[model samples]
Target: MNVAVSIDARTALLFSPCRLAGLDLRSRIVMAPMTRCMAEDGVPGPATASYYARRAAADVGLIMSEGIGVDHPAALGEGTFGERNMPVLQGAAAIAGWRAVTDAVHAAGGLIFAQLWHQGPLRRPGSGPQPRAVSCRPDGRWGPLDGSTSAPPDYLEAVRPPTVAMTDNDIADVIAAFGRSAAHAQTAGFDGIALHGAHGYLIDSFLWPETNSRVDAWGRTLAARTRFAVAVIEAVRAAAPALPVAFRYSQWKLQDYDARLVDTPDMLAALLAPLVDAGVDLFDVSTRVFHRPAFAGSPLSLAGWTRRLTGVPAIAVGGVGLSRELKDSLMAVVPAEDNVARAVVAIERGEFDLLGVGRALLADPDWARKLRQGAPLPAFSPAAFATLI
Candidate 1:
C-alpha cells in the first residue's frame, strides 16, 4: 500500500487493540520511552505527569516513562553537563514522585509503565560515586577521571568508575532492588514495568563479553552472561506477578556504538534462551533503524527475529515516525514532521507489534490523535524539549 493511500484509509495496524498481561491497551501505537532529563532528583513531578498525560489523553496506548533508577547508590548520579534537569529515581521520595506521575496517567485513562534503568558506566566519572565501566580498561572507564576543575570533564570523567566488582551478594542485592522497585511501581499505580536491558546499560554490560570478562558463574558463556538479566526478571516477576514485564534489548552500546550481541542465528538463540525462560512477557528489540535486516540474507528485522526466537510479542523502535533516522537528527536544531503515512504502512506489514513514537511525540503530545483524525502533523522542533518542562 502507498503512503498516501494508507494515510487516507486510516487502517493502520498500529491502531488495533491488543492485550498484554491482561491489561488492554487502546492501540498498538506505543509512546516510546524518551529521557527528557526533566525529573527532579530522579523523581518525576507535575510537569512530567502533565507531559505524559497529554499524550495519553491524545490516545497513546502505552506510555513508557523514561529510564527510572532503582533504589541503588550506583544507579543515582548528578545531572550531566548541559542537563539542568537530569532526574534520578533514588530514595523513598523518588518512588513517591513516580507515584504521582502514574496516578495522573491512570486518571487520564492511560496505561503507563516505568522503564527501570541503571546508568552503569554511563554515569560520568567523578561527578558521583565511582562509576562502573563494562571494561576495566581506562578507555572503557565510565567517562574520564581527570581532576581538571575547568571545562566540564569529558563524558568519562563526569562519572565515578566502579572500583569494586559485584560479588554474589551484590548481585543478589541488585536483584532485590529491582524487585522492590517493581513492587513500588505497583503501589504507585503503574500498569506495567519494562526492564531497560538495552543501550549498553547494567544488564547489557553483563551480556557483552568485552565488558563482562570475569570467569565467575555469571561470566563464562553467553548463557552465563544471561544470568544477571534472568535474576532481575525472576525477581520482578515474583514481586509483581500481575504486572507484565517487558525486556528491552539492543545490539549497540553507547560506549562502542557499533556493538552487536549476536552475529549469527545460533548465537542469537543462545543469548535469548535464558531471558525467555525467566518470564519476560514481551521483547523490545531496539535498533537505530527498524527496517534494516538484522543479519545477512535474513528478511527478518531485529524485532522479527526476537518474536520468532521467543514466541513473545515484540516492540520495534528507532526512527519509527521520523522521515529520517533519529541518530542523524539528534543534533539538528529542529526535526522534520513525522511521516505517519510511512509508519502506518510498516505497521500494516506486521514488521513488529508496536510502533514507538519518540521525538515526534516529544514535539507534539497529540501526534497520535492527529494521525487518527488524519490531521496535519506539526513540525518537530528540538526547542520543544526545553519548553515542555
Candidate 2:
C-alpha cells in the first residue's frame, strides 16, 4: 500500500486504461524490469513476490518481472554479484514460485509480464558454465561510446571471457527454451511475456554487428542477425497464441552506448518490419534518456520511430524519474519533478504507449502515489538500493 493519490490533473493522465498488443492494462505506468537477483537456485522466493506485490498495490500498471532466466545453459549463466538470486524459471519450483508472484500482483489489480533473459558473452567467468554467444567476442567489445575512459568496468566487463558460439542444436535449444518458458508464464497466470533483447545481452549481442561476427544465417546482415530473435519470438507465439509478446530492443548496447543496429531510418524500417512480421505485438524500446532524439535532427526518440515504423504499441524507458542515463543510474541521485512531467507530456503526445519508471520506483516503491500527491521524493541512495532485493 501507498498513500492515496488525490487524482489531480497530472496523475490522471497516467492512470487511464490503455490496450497494449491486445492485453489491456489499468494504467500507463509500467514497472521497468530491475534485476533484484534474489532468487535462490533460479526460483523466485517469497520476498520476490512481496517485492513486486508492493509496487503492484501502489498502482504500477504493469510489472515486467526481473530478467527471468531461460532454460538455456548460458542464460545469464552466472548470476549477479557472485550470487544466483536472479530468478531462473527453468524448473517446477521456479514455475511455482513465479505463480505466487503473479497471483499476488493480480490480487492487487495489476498486470505482470515475465521478461525472458540470456546474457551471452556478458556472462561472468566464475558463473559456472561458460556463456554461449552469437560470436566469440569478449565483453566490452565495442567499449564506452563516450570519449571518456576513466569509468571503471562493471561486473559484465570484469573477469569475463570470450563466449563460444552456439552450435546448430544449441541455437535450436535456446529458442525452444524461450517457448517453453512462455508457455509456463501463461500457465502461471501472467498476462504476457517480453524477450530481453536489449542492453547487449544475449539477444542484443546477436543484433549488434560488433558482437555478432557469425557468417551463417544467424548473422552477416541485419535480417540475418534478427533470425535468432525471430525464431525465439515465433516459438513464444506458438507456445502461447493468446499471450501478448512484447519485444524489448535498442539501437545502442551496454557494450557501446553509441552502437547502431542500422544507419538510416530506411535501415531501421528494414530491421523492425521483419521482426514485427515474426510475431512481436509490442515493443519496449530502451534508451539512456527518453527525451534525446534517437537519430540526429529528429525529435522522435527510439520508441517514437518504432511506433512510426511499426504502428505497433511501444513503451519508452530511460531517466523518466531520476534523470540518469542507463549507465549513470548506478549512482545515487535525486528525482526531479519537471523531468517526470516532461515524460508524461511525451506520452500525451503519443510518442510511446507507456512510460517505465526505474530508479524512482527503486528508490521508493510508492513513487507513483507520491508523484500524484505532489509529495517530495526521497533521494535514491545506496542504502535504499540495498533494500531492493
Candidate 3:
C-alpha cells in the first residue's frame, strides 16, 4: 500500500481553523485524553509537561489533558486507584504543576483543555476511609480503562471493593470540588475545561441506569439521572464563564459495552437537553469505532448526531487512524489506513466537527503534522507508552 505525504482534498479542510463557542483552535485535530499515570504526590512533573508539549509542538489542534481529579473526597486517591499516580487540580503544588503544563502547551503553539474528573463508584478499596458510590453497587473484580473503552484490564480499578451509597452531602461536596477544579484550570491558563462525564466515572455512573438505581431525586427517571451531570456542567460554567465547556460522553460502559444511555436517538437528544441548556459548548462523543453508524438507520456517528441535535461542535473519536482501538493489553495498537479515509469522508459530509486521534497520537506525535505535510506515518507500538516519545 502506497501512502503519500501530501494533504488530500478530503482532509485539507480539517486543517483549517475552527472555533467552538469561545475557544479557538488552529485545526480540527483534537488529541484525545489518554492517562499516562506519570504524576506523583498529586502533582504533574516536568516529564508530564514534556510529553504533552511534544504533541503541541507537532501541531495538534487541541489537546485534552489526561483526566485530573478534583479536590473532592471521593476523587482519585487513598481509596480509589492507588495502583497508579494521577495528577490533581487542588493544592498549591498541584496548581503550579499543571500551570507548567498549560504554559508548555501554549509555548508550543497549541491549546489545551483540563478534564475535571471524579472517581465515583470506581474507587479502589482501602485507598480512603470508605468506598462510596451512586448506589451500593460493587465494581466487581475488574473494570475497563475508562467509561467508554471496551478494551480491558481495568486500567487501575481497585480489586472488588464494596462501595457505600453516596449521601446528599457527599454529592454536594463532589460537585463543589468540580467547580473549584474549573477555577483552578482557568488560573492555570487552560483555554477551556472538559468535564469527564463519560466512561464509568462518577458523572457517568450517575447518568447510567445500571450503576444508578437510586429512588431519590438523583435517580429513577431520565431527568433525575442527568441531574448530577447537569449540576457539574452548571457549576463549571459558573466558575469559568468565559471558558468553553466541553463534555465527553459515551453510551457504552466498561462494565457493559452494550449499555445505552438512551437506546434511541430521540432519547439521546432528550438526555442531552439539560446539559446543553446548562452551558456545554461542545460534545466530545467517544465511540469504539469512529465511522460506525451510531443508530439503526442513519450513517451518522455519535458525534454526528450530537452536532445535528444540539447545534454545537462535536468531536468524533475512536480508531481515527488505527485498525483497532487497541489490539489487547499486550499488543495495544495496530495500523489501519482505511480508518483515516473513513474519517475524511465523514468530515467532508459534515458528520462531525473535530476529529480526535487517540492511540495514534500516543504512538506517533507527528501524526497530524505529517498528514498535513504529506509525509508517511509510522506504525504504532505499545512501547511508546514506556517513554515521553
Counting clashing residue pairs in each candidate, in order, gives 18, 5, 11
For residue 174, give model 2's deviation from the true position in Å: 1.0
Ranking by lDDT: 3, 2, 1
Off by over 4 Å in 1: 1-6, 78-92, 128-153, 157-162, 333-349
Q: Which ten residues in a row have the lowest lDDT in candidate 1?
A: 135-144
lDDT of each: 0.72, 0.75, 0.77
lDDT of 1 by residue, 134-159 (tens): 32211243422232222244644434
Q: What is residue 128's positional error in candidate 1, in angstroms?
A: 4.8
The runs of at least 3 residues in candidate 3 whose Cα sits more than 4 Å from the true structure, single-residue gaps closed, are: 1-7, 77-83, 128-161, 327-333
- Ten contiguous residues with the weakest lDDT in model 3: 133-142
Deviation (Å) of 217 in candidate 3 = 1.1
RMSD (Å) of each candidate, 1 decimal: 4.7, 3.6, 3.6
Predicted candidate 2 versus true structure: per-residue lDDT over 54-164, tens digit per residue: 888887988888888777666765543454567777668988999999999989888899999877666665464333334223223433445322234666466344445
Best by lDDT: 3
